[model samples]
Target: MDPIQRITTPTLDVLDALLTVDGPAWGLLVIKATGRQAGTVYPILERLERQGWITSSWDDETDRPGPRRRLYEFTPDGVDAARDLVAARPSAATPAPSAATPARPARSARPVTS
Candidate 1:
């Protein structure tokens, strides 16, 4: 399946949140940003990691499986991709349709002539 097609709005939201956060975040923050369940968010995170879009490592300083966190952060490619995503964001601030680029005249709308 197409990767973009598989990416839901939540997936994009989660990705954006990760980029926004300077440090690694726990699963909870991801769930909050995407408004998705832990189950759903984790899988997407794993997929992104496996795809080399992001990387994750357990905090050495944190107590593993205790209060420790499994933090994640974007790779260089991920940053580039995020920038691309941001640029692609549609903005309402954009001016209305310009008359310069008029809609194409429909073939069916051609006038009947003798």
Candidate 2:
């Protein structure tokens, strides 16, 4: 992610969760940790992926119970950058979005045309 990008509260919570963990994190885990809905958590995850800050893969361990999970973790450079961003603004890390905050519009599968 660009250093100058505006880090939203949800994004900061996600980063904090990832940083505190020992290994790669999954979507549900992050969602619980941040106390944010899937809508808020997922878009931030996608944006982070597009910015090359994080990587994800399917958990293929057969020994594990339950369905496969998509796991995520920061890239080598992203580790430092994430820490810097969090440390730079500790007060910005709010875990929940207020009820007054407007929800983002859902994206449609079809492409828009003029």
Candidate 3:
């Protein structure tokens, strides 16, 4: 499987969600797990498929009430690459405000100009 070419927050989020599951996942499940909109999630899935990092297949359960879901799973090699990429990414759990990009000052900090 080919490694993902361009990595972004959305892409990484999708990958992270996939890694948590034990098997293939569907688009809606991924959207929920990543907290990404459908617009962002589908394109990311397509690109990852094109890059050969993942594969998709339609679920074949005939007993289901609605249409079959398209499930996505990382290719064997993709699992390893995804782990490495995530490990290298900066942690987003709780970003500290750096001096270069300071957080907004409190309302009381503003000068009491006439």
Candidate 4:
């Protein structure tokens, strides 16, 4: 697989989401896991597939009563690459700030008239 040219945060998030799953992940699952919209997730998936980082196939289960979902999983080499990439980003491992942690107040745009 060619090296990913630009590893954006959304891409990292998608990779991280994929890592958490045991088997091939569908697009919506990745979307929900990353809390990213379809617009952002689908393109990343397509790019990853094009770069050979991942492979996709249409779900063939006949019993399922819905549209065939495209399943995506990393190639043997892709998994290692993805893990290394995700691990290198410190922010990826950082947990979301909890409610107990006070949020920083947003600065007002208007200048103070004092």
* Best candidate, TM-score: 4
For residues 29-84, write the lDDT of model 4, one tens digit per residue.
Answer: 99999999999999999999999999999999999998999999999999999999
Global CA lDDT of candidate 1, please? 0.73
Task: Report every candidate's CA lDDT.
Answer: 0.73, 0.85, 0.88, 0.95
Clash count in backbone of candidate 3: 0
C-alpha lDDT of residue 46 in model 1: 86
Clashes of 4: 0
Candidates in descending TM-score order = 4, 3, 2, 1
Candidate 3 lDDT score at position 64: 88
TM-score, cand. 3: 0.78
Ranking by lDDT: 4, 3, 2, 1
Question: Candidate 3 on 6-70: residue-level lDDT in tens?
Answer: 78889999999999988999999999999999999999999988888899999998998888999
On TM-score, the stronger of 2 and 3 is: 3
Question: Would you list the clashing residue pairs of candidate 3?
Answer: none
How do the residues 3-84 of candidate 2 rate in per-residue lDDT, one tens digit apiece? 5385777788888888988899999999998899999998888888888899999998999999999899999988898898
For lDDT, the strongest prediction is 4
Candidate 2: stretches off by over 4 Å: 91-114
Where in model 4 is the C-alpha error above 4 Å? 91-114
Better of 3 and 4 by TM-score: 4
Tens digit of per-residue lDDT, candidate 1, span 4-78:
435566667778788778778777788887689888889888887877777888778844456767788888887
For model 2 the local lDDT of residue 18 reads 85
